[model samples]
Target: MTIHQFYQPPLHWQQFEEFAVQLLAEVYDVPTAQQYGRSGQAQHGVDVYGRSRKHGLIAMQCKRLSDRDANNQPYPGGPITREFFFAEAQAIEDFPHAVSIWILVTTARRDTRVQGYAEELNEQWEKNGIDRTATVWSWDDCVSHLNSYPDLRKRYYRDVIQVNSVDDLDQMVLETISMAFNRTAFELPLHIETPDEFLQALQDTQRAVRTGELLDRKSRHVIRKSIGGWRQIHNRDWQAALGKIDKDLRALRAGVEHGLKDGSIRRTSNYLDFADRRKADELEELRSGCVRDLSAVLIEAGLPPI
Candidate 1:
């Protein structure tokens, strides 16, 4: 679902830490808790701490190591140093019963160096009569985890992965209209045969104009102006041509604007499952209706009829 695009920076440190705590809580299925080490500051290096029934004490820190300096000068995010993991290892001293610490970062990629350092530190801790381990979750790991929660991604990163905005719908409508005109001008070869075929072709062209799938208000106004101007210049009966198409175009435009007023295309699961069951049939009707005025207007406008 293009989740990786949301791993970019500009997220506040507190927000990042809060999200990390949520992730850790979900992972451990534990009641999340926090502690203050000395005075009012968080204990050791742990920003969030919790205890799991199965895994005992767990600590986590979220590091949004930005690609910009404190002065806002741009730089690389990292190749986080091994010592960073060592510093996080110090947090285990505060939670003497801690089984593991998770260091989450937005800068590094894999961070195997930090993982290796933690493994070595775990071995040393065993010899010194302490038992603790550390693990670093890099940007890739965080994205992979977050992708599992589609609702959470939608809530927090909706702007990052936008779909079906009004502008997008307008583009779709413009392209569809353009394609219809091209087909009317160049396709259909011989004259439509049989009374049924002739009537069906006219219906299709009219339906295409009337369907109103994605033609928004301002875009419809601009398109109508262009078409009206073209008709005025090239056709003697410009009023007749505009009369046949303008009302449908106006309705289509209004429908598109109303559908996209909220700027979100997300649909309820049940609605998506059952909505527009006859979409294919409706589309076929619209496609057939696209050449309704081709014989009269399009040909006179220097675009030969299909």
Candidate 2:
């Protein structure tokens, strides 16, 4: 979808989870009567559940990893740790009458190791009559599958997804970053004086880094240098602001730089680009805030405001 459409108020994680449950139910031809009966509980090692018309029941564990994680080394043990496998298998076993499929739905593109772990878990669960199967679906799979459902597809699948593929995860990340932006943006005037607007902008910069959307060492360094230069321009001590920005920028930069050096970033350019844009947008917001603050100060001093 267009970035604008992807970020409609109804597209938060809660809404996405519901959409995922509903989509899976429809795709498998599970009866509508049985669809609402499906249960979803976030962070309990499960996100969606339902019974298929013929294949029996299905259980899904959704991991909505940020684009940052997509562009990183596969955790050595794969995405499914033994604990996660055991918990999903246990959930299936607990519901004995229905056959279950444990699916790991990620925003990341397909990874062989992650796929392999799912296959291995299925085999292990079979020994206990749990009848579980695991599969990994990425943003690419979602777009391809959704295309068949012309109605919903037409509403949500924009050129952005097609162009970026896995990078579509950025829509979600951007939404998240926007949340922080809004929070800090509103709080700016209330928390500090007009001249201290740089501090507010600095907080937003730190917020972006903490959100993990800035995915490059050099990119982050540029941001930090820019913020530092701005802070000096304003001649405010703002040590607290400086520390927060420095810490977050360093952490985010390290992660992205590591991913870049390992080739993960290249493999997931679509997702990374979106994240990069969010960081850029944040920098722009900071710059704008600086200008606003300077104008406010000029007006307060009875000088012609720029």
lDDT of each: 0.48, 0.46
Tens-digit per-residue lDDT, 216-243, candidate 2: 2223321211111222222233323433
**Candidate 1's residue-wise lDDT over 141-224, tens digit each?**
776766776655665556545634433333333333444454331244222222233233334333343332222222432122
Point out where model 2 deviates above 4 Å: 1-12, 31-46, 66-79, 127-130, 155-198, 205-306
Q: What pairs collide in candidate 1?
A: 203-289, 204-288, 204-289, 204-290, 205-288, 205-289, 205-290, 205-291, 206-289
Model 1, 71: alpha-carbon shift in Å? 19
**In candidate 2, which residue pairs get closer than 3 Å at backbone N, Cα or C atoms, i.e. clash?**
1-158, 167-270, 167-271
35 Cα displacement, candidate 1 (Å): 7.8
TM-score of each: 0.45, 0.47
Off by over 4 Å in 1: 1-6, 31-42, 68-79, 96-99, 102-106, 161-306
